[model samples]
Target: MSDWLSDQAGYVWLIIAALLAICELLIPGVYLTFIALGAAATGILALVFPELGAIGQFISFAAWSTVAVVVGKRWYGANPVPSADPDLNNRAARMIGQSVTVVEPISGGTGRVRVGDGEWPAEGPDLAAGDKARIVAVRGGVVVVEAVKAIEADLPDQPRDDQTQSKG
Candidate 1:
C-alpha cells in the first residue's frame, strides 16, 4: 500500500479530493469539506513537484486540511445568519407590536388573548375581555399586552337632560 501510494503520479490526490467532496454531500456537515481541500492541495503539490515523495504529499494534505478547517470555522463563526429558515424558530418574536384582544380577563398579570384567530397566554396589567390590547413583548411563547383606550359607543338617545342636571 505504501509503495503504491508513493509511486502514484499526478491527479491521484485530485481523485481523493473528489471522493471527499462527495462524502461531504452525503454526510451533510463541515468536516469533509476541509479534507477535500487538503486533498486538492496535495494534488496541486503533486502537479507542481512531480518527484515529491509520499511523505511530502501527506504533509501537504495535513497542513492544508488544518488551514481549511480553521479558516472555515472563523468565517462561519463571525457571520452566523441562520441560512436554513428565516422564520423557523421565531413565531412569537414576530408578534411584537401587533394589536390583539383580550379573550379572558387578566386579574393579576395573567390572561388569555386572541390575536389573528389564535389564542395565546398573556401577561400584563388587569385587562377585561373585549378590551383592545397591543402586544408589547414576547417571552417563551407568552405574549405581553398593554390595554389601549376604549372606543366610545355612539348613542343617539336623549341624555341631554341628565348631562345638564349633573353639570348643575
Candidate 2:
C-alpha cells in the first residue's frame, strides 16, 4: 500500500484537489473555492514534476494557497455582488422616509413612534401624541424623525386666491 502511494503521489494530490473542490461546492462561500484552486495548482505541479516529492509538493501548495487567498480578496473587493434586497436584514433602515404616528409625545427630542405594527424609539422636534411624522434617519436602532406638518411647510407655494370670493 505504501509503495503504491509513493509511486502515485501525483494521483493522490489530484484526489485531494477534487475533494477540496467538492467541499467548496457544499459550502457557498468562496473561501473554500480559493483553497481548492491552490490544491488543484499543486496537483498540476506534482503531475508536471514527478521528481518533486512530498516536501516540495507541500511547499508549493502553501505558496499557491497564499496567492489564491490574496487574489480572491482583491477580486471580491473590486467587484462586490449586489444584494437583491439591500435592506433585507436591516428593518430599521427600511423605515427611512416612511410615515409614523406618534404613540407618545416626543419631548426633549426623544419619544416613541408607531411604525408599521411596532413602535420604535424616536428622536426629533417636539410633537404631541397622535401627531404624524416621517422617518428621516435611523441612529443606533432609534428612528430620527421630522414632523409631517414641517415637511408640508417646506413644499412650494399653493395657488393664490386673490380672484376668489365667497359664494353669495
Candidate 3:
C-alpha cells in the first residue's frame, strides 16, 4: 500500500483538491476554494515532474496556496457584488416617503406616529393627533417627518354668507 501511494502521489493530491472544493461549496466564503486551487496545482506539478519528492510537493502546495489567496482577495476587492435591494434589511429606511398618521400629538420635537400596525417614535413639526405626516428620514430609531400639505380640493365646501341667505 505504501509503495502504491508513493507512486500515485499525484492522483492523491487531485482527490484532496476535489474534497476541498466540495467543502468550499458546503461552507462558502471564498476561502477553501483558494486552498483547493493550491492542491490542484500541486497535483498537476507532481504529474509533470514525476521525480519531485514529498518535500518538493509540500513546498509547491504552500507557495501556490499563498498566491491563490492573495489573487482572490484582489479580485473580490475590485469587483464587489452589488445588492439588488440596498435597504432590504433596513425596516426603518424602507419607510422613507411613506405617509403615517400622528397617533399621539407631536410636541417638543418627539412623539409617536402610526407606522403600519405599529407606532414608532417620530420627530417633526407640532402635529395634533390624527394629522397626516410624510416620513422624510430616519435618525436612529426615530422617524423624521414633515407635515403633509393639505390639498384644498379634498376640504369640504363651506357656504358663504350670501349663498346661505334665501333668495328674495
Candidate 4:
C-alpha cells in the first residue's frame, strides 16, 4: 500500500484538489478554495520530485494548506466583494436617510410618519403634524426620526378673516 501511494501521490493530490474544488462550489464559503490551492501545489511538487515518499508528500500538503489558508484569509478579508444592495432583504432598513412628514404628533419619542404614500410608526423628538422629519434609523418595526423643518412655521403670514376660510 505504501509503495502504491508513493508512486501515485501526485495523481492522488490532483484528484483531491478536483474534489475540493467541487465541494467549494457546493458550499460557497470560499474556505475550501484555500485547501484546493494547497492540494494543487502539493500535486505539482510531487510531479516534479517523484522520488519523494508518501509521508513527505502528506507533510508538504499540510504545510501548503496552512500557508494557503492564512494568505487567503488576509487577502480576501482585507478586500471583500460588497453586495450591490446590502439592505435589499429589509425594506424598512433601506428607508433610512429619507425625508418624511409627521402624520401625527410625536410625544415621548413615538408617533407616525409618512414616506411617500405609506405611513409608519416612528420614534424621535416631539413634533407636531405637518412637520418635516428625516428618517435616521429603523428599530424593529419602528423608525427613528428627527425634525428637519416646520414647513408651516416657515411660511409667510396670511389673513385669517377671509370669506373662503370661514368654518361652518
Predicted model with the maximum TM-score: 3
**lDDT of predicted model 1:** 0.87
lDDT of model number 4:
0.91
Cα deviation of 42, candidate 3, in Å: 0.8
| C-alpha positional error of residue 75 in candidate 2 after TM-score superposition, expressed in Å | 1.6
Write model 1 residue lDDT over 31-95, tens digit each, in one string. 89988998998898898898898888899899999999999999989987565656566878778
Clash pairs, candidate 2, are none
* Rank by lDDT (best first): 3, 4, 2, 1
Task: Give the higher-lDDT candidate: 2 or 4.
Answer: 4
lDDT by residue (tens digit), candidate 4, 26-136: 996999999999999999999899987778888999999999999999998899989999988989888999999999999888999998899999999999998899999
- Separately for all candidates shown, the number of backbone clashes (residues 3 or more apart, or on different chains) is 0, 0, 0, 0
Instruction: Point to the candidate with the largest lDDT.
Output: 3
After TM-score superposition, what is the CA distance of residue 57 in candidate 1 from its true location, in Å? 2.4
lDDT of 2 by residue, 19-125 (tens): 88898888888897778788888888888888888899899989998999999999999999999999999988899999999999999999999999999999999
TM-score each candidate: 0.70, 0.80, 0.81, 0.68
lDDT (10s digit) by residue, model 3, range 46-89:
98998889999999999999999999999999998899999999
All-Cα superposition RMSD per candidate: 7.1, 4.3, 5.1, 7.9
RMSD, model 1, all Cα superposed? 7.1
